[model samples]
Target chain A: MSTATLNVTTVKADFPLLGREVNGHPIVYLDSGATSQKPRQVLDALDRYYEEINANIHRGAYLIAEKATTAVEDSRAALAGFVGASAAEEIVFTKNATESINLVAHSWGRTNLSEGDVILLTTLEHHANIVPWQQLAAERGVVIRWIPLDDDGRLDLTDLDQLLDGVRLVAVSAASNVLGTLPPVRRIADAAHAVGALCLVDASQWVPHYPTNVADWDCDFMVFTGHKMCGPTGIGLLWGRRHLLDAMPPFMGGGSMIQNVTFEGFTPADVPTRFEAGTQPIAEIVGLRAAVDYLNAIGMEAIRQHELDLTAYAMRTLTERFGDDLAIHGPHDLENRGGTLSLAYRGIHPHDLSQVLDQHGICVRAGHHCAKPLMKVLGVNATARASLYLYNDESDVDALADGLAAAGDFFAF
Target chain B: MAGLEDLYREVILDHYRSPRNRGELETPPAIMAEGFNPLCGDEIQVYLLVEDGVIAEIRIGGQGCSISQSSASMMSAAVLGRTPDGAREVLRSFKEMMSIHEHGLDGEPISTDDQPGASGLGDLEALRGVVKFPVRIKCATLGWNTLDQVLDQTGT
Candidate 1:
């Protein structure tokens, strides 16, 4: 399933945004890590769902309502299958990855965590994974510990046993959005289970780029977003073990999540419906199903290989062209990294550099990347980040290099 | 290349490399205000030494992008010797020059050199190109906004 057999140009053509121009030049979109451009397949799914099957799911007995309900439930099943979940009932749809984590924090954290309990997390987590726990910890008087990062920006796992002691939950990102360093999720999950702690993996960055198997990773809970994987926004997924989800209380109280409601109290529904409180994003779930189908058609292994090749080529080209003037954060090797290149060029502010690059129609993210804690740890305010996807190729990387060289020339003293 | 030159003029880079009033004022009766752009992690602190309703001394301290730091430096140079009202006028003029509104000066069919209130802009006119880059406008005006906060705090 290597990308050598995959025609990269045809893949690029699938995304309509890739064909557009900006600022009188062809657009080189390298910000897929922030949000991926949707392919026509996913877009068509949304359009068809609205035009043909627009109805409120789960309540109405009309034909269109039944069709809409089938579409939404079928999407859950397909998404569960894509992530290798044991059953579709274990998949819970939410607004986005942020709400997915917050659901766990509010429901599971409020129930399980108490005073003197500790929740361990890694430094590479986005604010989404960090702030929820911090809020829960503040309310419950619980302690929070961190897994430090080594100089190369990979998680320092040498003291995993010590950090896991007295820990009730361990949350970590499978891949750092800032550094592109893929932490060993399987090892971390095994260690957390050995310590009798439930492990949660933030797969927002990992599931979009790599071959993800919740069963293989053996994590207790996992979450990822649809928009980052060529689907529409306003839809995400949370997959947990059936037993854990059943035991946890409902995160939000509403109509769809309850089985029986009295004037006094309510009895919650089963595992997934217990979490989906209100009406879900029906069209987005359908679009997400189409996105999953598109990825499966291309194959995750091929996508990973293509991104690795592009990453290797970008690292070499940028290093050769800029020399010491360009410094890329994270691991130098592509073995444990993805196609995200966070670069610092000769004291040029990332905002300034990104503005210069934008003039050439090269889009790159220049900010803390929602990982301000990681920014403080790395001793930088921000890095100009150029992230690649399956649609990107070596020419896009070359265009990035040329834009950076122009930045140098423009800002040269 | 022409647009790039317009945005990062030699005067802006010169101020970035060797900033004017690039320190804190130890004198008393000075008001300090800090501005931060959480998006890009740009932070700038402005200190003003106001006496008799005039900014007798001004100093800026922070770390940020070239546009921000250079704008702060040029802002210090522009308003150092002006009274409180005069400094506010300078701030308003700079904002006008950097404004990207539909009916404001940025939208007018006029050259950057002949822009209204060009005489009041002095070296601050180097930032006129920021109007073309909408996202970077915050970087160019972070210092001016902070100084406005400082002035408001002084109640003058």
Candidate 2:
């Protein structure tokens, strides 16, 4: 094994799901861009919480209630520190990145944006970022504008100033789900800030692969999901400036988010709690903290380097083997991309391509990947994507290569 | 354990490479049905030339996985020139066989002849292996679903 492989394997021991077999062959999981596999440490943390201190946080004066409250607050603090935020109050627990984006769209978007005002978003954003704004625009008569993408799937920064003019809010993904291109986010944020527009970053694909500093990016709001980062599902986070969150109205009204309830009037709680109205996913939060710690232990910089190297290897080997028959989507250069590779065989459907890969125990995602507008822009109905994460290696790429060849031959007479 | 080779049988590859009845039908008096797999974005549009309750001609167009394409290719060939009732019976049999579980027709024969007495699938029997791979079953049934939709339009 190479040094990267050795490092990944050492990390694999912590995740039990990596050792399983699918279709009677060792599972070569290449679908991490969809959802990552969880580690034993994360699972153990969840189990420990349920077993030891299962109680409604801040509800009762009992010892367990205090312990639960401490655990939740401690996790919030850790998460705040992980993202280099000012305080735990800046982080609000959400269901997923989808909910976070929706919360912002429904709360700030409905209240602030108006007719003739434009919401600027990148052409390559996930549906979560695009659809919410589109819905809000349709409802409120706000005009929606797009920052066009280049041939390499990178953002076209040439018109950044023009696009930001009169834009109430700018939303974009940190990384494209299909092309894997990391946008010039800091520059985009700076441009948006210059125009007095709030920039929201959908870091669902980026936070798992790289270290994220909201303060460094100076983004007004950011959203990410836990499952994509090897944490439990049904849990995500929305990080926003304390002032912006405080000013926005409550997204959902419920018991915990209210300071005092009366027949005449009800007062809202503070920032994060005011947004998080329902009983949160307590276990998922605990598990996400463990996932954060796991990433910290391995170090994000080293992991990012490992993934970059793997992506380079995959691009080189795949391009050399299949040539033009394998049409790779997104950026041409590895440095301009993330770990996801969306490609299509010349005349074969992605469903067939994925089936052949499944036979080799290689898990890959196939289809539009929830970016239909981008798919129409790319001029294809669907494409097969093989995504890499911390646990993937050269062998997995080899499996995908072999599977593509088999699909090519099978589809050909 | 069924291998990839088993999943991609020679017959399936043959049907996929040189699909049968792969064309558009005449527009007038033609009923069309489309089937889509949201998971893989596989799609099929089936057109039938029906004449006084009989399937006078059948044609299909769309893009999909090899199994779905091949299945549509074979389906257009299978149900052509058969009465709506006869075609539904044959489709029912094909669906039953594709289920893979025991349905009490193991010893019985499926005929492929176009004559009034011929009543079973001969070349399509190769799809029996698809039962081992459950996900591919939908691929094999896209054309059949279209057939059902066409039959539904026939009011049979």
Candidate 3:
């Protein structure tokens, strides 16, 4: 908050994992797209939670149990604020983003959707968003339509009106994990609403890198994971509109989600509680609160600005260094994309490139990035992705370029 | 710490550069089967031409990283003239070569008797370096697994 830009050195110091070495070399972690390294603040929060206030939340009545309940609610409120949601009860914590999406498909889709109804999705969706809808379609005989991608890898929304016709729900990713293309989420939400359809944005990649305001986007539902945002794993967020969640049934039924059980019929709790069953991820929620605090301390605007500069540097460096030998997928417009770079080295396989980079202690993900449909659009089975976060700086990008050069030489025929 | 030279042996790179018996064969006479490493989107297809008890001919199809493609090329070359039982022998030996070092990775002692070269699998022996990188073990075995599936499907 004090500074306009994030000091990469100070931010890097906050994360303990970056201080560690791999294979006798300093680690250049560029795989933030998969999962981010935890900051000491978040780790300390976890330690504090387990040591001081480990108990079942939402049901316990004693001192430590009450403290645990308060901690979980406080984290929910923090997450609601982080995503620009007015009500804390709108946030339902799931295992991760995949589970969050599934909760929506099962609770909302199962209750509201029927046979022949259409769910419009884009090629940019991760398997989490795509498969849930496909599962719903299989069960209900619902039809699924696709929003194609253009040559620039952004959504081709030329036939938006036609695609929205008869569509009950529209699900799409805010920023593509593979291509880093930031679709027009607000415009899509507006169009879907015009046709009396609901919109859900899978912001798993977008929320960490950008300033998010759910109210501004006006989407019915949104989802993101914790570990990807420097929080602990095993916790995720699903923020829904009050009206939508009010009508939907509970996703999972158990002790915490029930109001009363009479051994005959049971009454389910309200909204978020109705979805979160069993003992909640108390320690993970505490860690998530700390992660949100850390991000707030640095400020999201500063983080986005940092990544914008770093991404430009990375694109220029890779092009100058590898020339036509390497092709980086996604939009060239700086404002339309995030810092994630999905690379295809002309002759070298992504798996081999990843292996070679690993030897040099450069961490990158080599896979379809859980967006197999996007990979098909890019004409690649898999890609080596190097994504940037607030902790990343220009030197990490330089290290990646150098490591790639070494890989080229090592794999040379 | 598996060195690049270990995984990318000259022979493995050679096979990857110029794969032997590449592309698919006729599926009617040559039974075709596919294997997938879902983690990396690595898919390998094996087409087998069986005659009596012999694996008369073989072709490797599909695409993946070096460990997968080169292993397929090497497997095709090694098992071309051998009977199905003899090919399974090489498959078992290759599988063993890739699995032997996994125990060493977990700090368990690996016997000196099971050296990669001790198997004497010829060009296929070069893939032993794959075990040092545990995640890549699947890539190295993708070809062998697909071939084994096809050989068994035909009851050869």
lDDT string for model 3 (A203-301, tens) is 999999988999999999999999999999999999999888989999988878988889798999888889989988889999999999999989999
- Native contacts kept, each candidate: 0.72, 0.72, 0.83
lDDT tens per residue, model 2, A75-188: 889889888899999999999999999999999998898998999998898889988898998898999999888887888899889888899899989998888988988999
Error of 2 at A43 (Å): 1.5
- lDDT string for model 3 (B37-116, tens) is 89999888999898877888899999899999999999999999888899999999888777777767886656733654
Candidate 3: list runs displaced more than 4 Å. A1-3, B112-117
- lDDT of candidate 2 at residue A275, scale 0 to 100: 88
Which residue window of length 10 is worst by lDDT in model 3 chain B? B107-116
Alpha carbon lDDT at A263, candidate 3: 70
For candidate 1, the per-residue lDDT at A68 reads 97
Q: Candidate 2's error at A389, in angstroms?
A: 1.2
In model 1, the Cα lDDT at residue B11 comes to: 87
Residue-wise lDDT of candidate 2 within B1-156, one digit each (tens)? 666675677877888888888878766678888887766666788888888767888888988777888888888788888898989988998887776332323533323322322336867876776766677787788789888987888877
Q: For model 1, what is the C-alpha lDDT against the true structure? A: 0.90
Worst 10 residues of 1 chain A by lDDT: A1-10
TM-score, chain B only, every model?
0.87, 0.84, 0.92
- Model 2 residue A15 CA deviation in Å: 1.6
